[model samples]
Target: MRRSTGHPRVRWSRRGAAGLVVLLALALLAGCAAGPSQRPPVAVRGELLPAAPPPPAAQAPADPDRLPEAEPLRSGPPFADCTDDVLAGLAAAGTPVPEGRTLRIGCGRLTVPADRNRPDLGPARLGLTKVTAPGAPADLPALVVLGDTGVDGSARAAARLAAQLPDPVLQRYQVIGMDRRGTGEDLLDCAPADARAALLDAGPERGDEAAMSALLERSRSIVQDCYLLLGGQLTSFKAAGSADDVEALRTTLGLARLNLIGVGDGADAAAGWVAGHPGAVGRVVLDGPGDPTLDEPARTEAVTAAAESAFDAFAGACATGPDCPLGPDPRASVRRLVDRLSGTALPVGDGDSLTAGATLRAVRTLLSQPSRWPELQTALAQADAGDGAGLARLLAPLGGPQGRFDAALATRCNDSRVRATPGEAAARAADWDERFPLFGVAAAQDLVACGPWPSGGQVAPATPQGSALPPVLVLGTAQDPRAPQSGAERTAEQLGNGRLVRWEGAGTGAYPRTPCVNAVVGRALLEGRAPAEPVVCPP
Candidate 1:
């Protein structure tokens, strides 16, 4: 929800289909998963127990990683009409779709209302790509793949998805990926470069009342600049509108039911979809899901703890690694490094210096991907040797190839109305040093980024819909630094037929990283059945 971590490279949420990209890379790894000796153990459940604990007695030897054999590409002529032409064609027709050749798979755009309530306000173009059902299309639900946040640059996401899909799935359903409304070619990059930089420089200046006031004013100014830059488009960039857009897409595609799968913040949109069309959706999947009902302090605190747990896991592994740059006491090394940075910034690159915010962001980014643990160790080691670019690579201003910064922030601010005042926010910030120590203050600082958000005239994304629908598969990667397992567990417990599938791992690769996970998900998707009870897959 914060702009500081806009770059997707370091985020728990990656480019393209956030869930699918991670899954594909992970599944490839799982086909030949390495042994414990080669893989660093990240905390998937709770705090770290020991550094480099002995391998399990029954552990089996691992095979070298190999490229997964690609699914046989279907041979066919591409879609007759482009996405825009197809949308226009559908609109010109009535309820029934054209017979010869409907939408197959190609790039297109959907013109949806900028604001659902104000249809006369004109429409925003949403980027889209559709993979039509292969061979004789079945009367199966279409798979609508969603990116975590409202980020774009996922023109290739569909291809990546096509590669990972089980052969059975490709023939049955059409897989769709959207660029939301204000992404892809329609992205709004109005915030001056300096404005985004300033956004990341937000902090309460050690909780000084005067400094807090200055920071609040600066925050307000940035928010105002964005509001103006968005040109009244801010209010409509929320999840509620995006949810309506999803419905429009469904109507455009002429599908009776959609297999809704939302990842990370995209879960909010999926929740909104179900809330609005409870009986219309089928096979709901929320991977790396977030709880829509969680309020502040608790939500921030939960996130902070989750992050620290992951960091501890990484620290433990790093301490045990023979050439660990963090030395024997990784925690102490980090504390000293942070303290040194707080006193004076380190030159990162091109005369740019690493600030506390950038440093923390770099650390958090590295912690999200356990596969990058060695890089984190190296970054720390490089910092000890007076080079900061290794960490600064994460904090550079960008969502890079996979983000729509303006839209992402708007989605958050428009929906989430922070009630904490500057003084109260400062109080929270002051307590973070004691509350969570490592990530607490930064977590609290993240909350302030939402301070300048408008309160009224915004609609809640989800309605009070019944959970008495079809069984939903919620995959929770334990010890996930961003979307922890507890949220997924709670979501499943709340649903009418929701089933919790636990994948014991630190990062967000539970579904694709474990062979058993792939089997479970493939069964659910192909056979239309999830385990009757909650299932657990141990690493």
Candidate 2:
């Protein structure tokens, strides 16, 4: 097994300010997902496609059931014991922690090659956190939880997940959270304050030819700036590299097998790890995984449709609920408010103006977390009343350096070989605007931002091999605005040993939300078996 006592304190390096300017633009664009475009048959070369083959398919493991009977846990080399420091750092970073949890939280950092193939570039560090409930056994199996691609707070995400999980599961496993590359001290933040303000304050008008052209150019600039900032190390942050890091972490921990719970882009890393290291798989769960097969256009359309459905659901709930802010006709109220805002910006504090684009972005974000739907309704009500502060606060978290647009764009573009032309992208956004007006243009604009990204050494989504692997559980939410239910269903079908569990609820994920869904997950993880028939939990 790989071993390490700990890594020495390493000084941080800040990239040029130019990179921050580009990242700010990209990050803002990613939030509202509004970008520039042009009308031409010509395909712009955004990402460079370097030749790289997929990881070799590993043979089936000798033991199909890698989970061992309760036994003494093996003690290997000690990893960095930074638990207290990590907790303090998380608090300082303002990562949201679930309230009133008494779990023991341990933290550490693992230094791995920046690029295993290019070790001369030095090493990159991955932050780690272990959460265990009181009286949990020392010999319990390890279950690693992965966060979404956009955020660098997987450890916090794990803590939140731990707080929601059933007591029995918590007592039976030591939950672990591993940060993706470019998190913590490695975060890049150098954008000028004025530049960031300009992006946030300005209106992202959809279907404007000038706005489209400028966005396309900005995409190119961000890609160029990223390459200049990261150079050879840029490719090291790809999803495949993250997969390798997972393997390294597993080996370093001296675990015969590592169970995993991956959400959103994190699911991609888990799938990649399973593809490369099949023998190490124990139990796996993919929560709302994106469909890797779809190109930009198809993916956007599906997402837009999902958003339309979720909004309708939200509107319906509001209509039926007492004292609803949206009045009797919530959909009509939303359309009127959007039209008013699009024509004239609502003045929020700090000179920032709330536009229709930002409002829709906030709506989408709120839709992903159903618990916050009340906040969305109130924000809309205030926006209609000419108070944009609520909406601007909603957009704040979606923008800035903390969103990690630089890392997200690089990883997303690097994972896919798909590149769409400027004209094709713009035309799709226009079509979406006409069809799914509320979220169509904003969501569709995402297609153009990645066009200028350099794409050499990209790794396609892992194609799972071997049928004898243990069952992998995939959870899907009925009204997931980001990743649609169809995509999750398809993902479950794509995996060799995949099982589908549907939650008839509105949210980005299902696990630990409903007792019915949690029971299904608990059974699968603890007993290493899944229901023969697909399970659907009611809202």
Q: Which stretches of candidate 2 lie over 4 Å from their true place?
A: 1-100, 183-185, 188-204, 456-463
In terms of lDDT, model 2 sits at 0.64
Q: Using Cα atoms with residue i matched to residue i, what is each candidate's TM-score against the true structure?
A: 0.72, 0.80
Clashing pairs in 2: 36-212, 36-215, 37-212, 47-453, 47-454, 47-455, 48-455, 48-456, 50-456, 83-107
Question: What would the per-residue lDDT of candidate 1 be over residues 130-189, giving only the tens digit for each residue?
Answer: 666435353445677665543232332343344345556666666666665455445544
Model 2 lowest lDDT segment of ten: 1-10
Highest lDDT: give the candidate number: 2
Query: How much does each candidate deviate from the true structure in C-alpha RMSD?
Result: 16.3, 10.3
Compared with the true structure, what per-residue lDDT tens digits does model 2 show for residues 1-539?
Answer: 00012312111132221234335544543432212211112221112111343233244435533332222245422333344555554454343345665577765555666776764555665656678886667667788887775644566667667867887888888888887776443453322333223333333355555555655666666655445445566666666887887787676656666688988677767777776666667678888877756756677788778888889889988999998998999899988987877788777644456777667767776777666788889989988988878776666555542445455656766765667666766677678778987876665456666676665444334546543456678888888776788766777666665678888887677888899988888887777656666889998
lDDT scores for all predictions? Answer: 0.56, 0.64
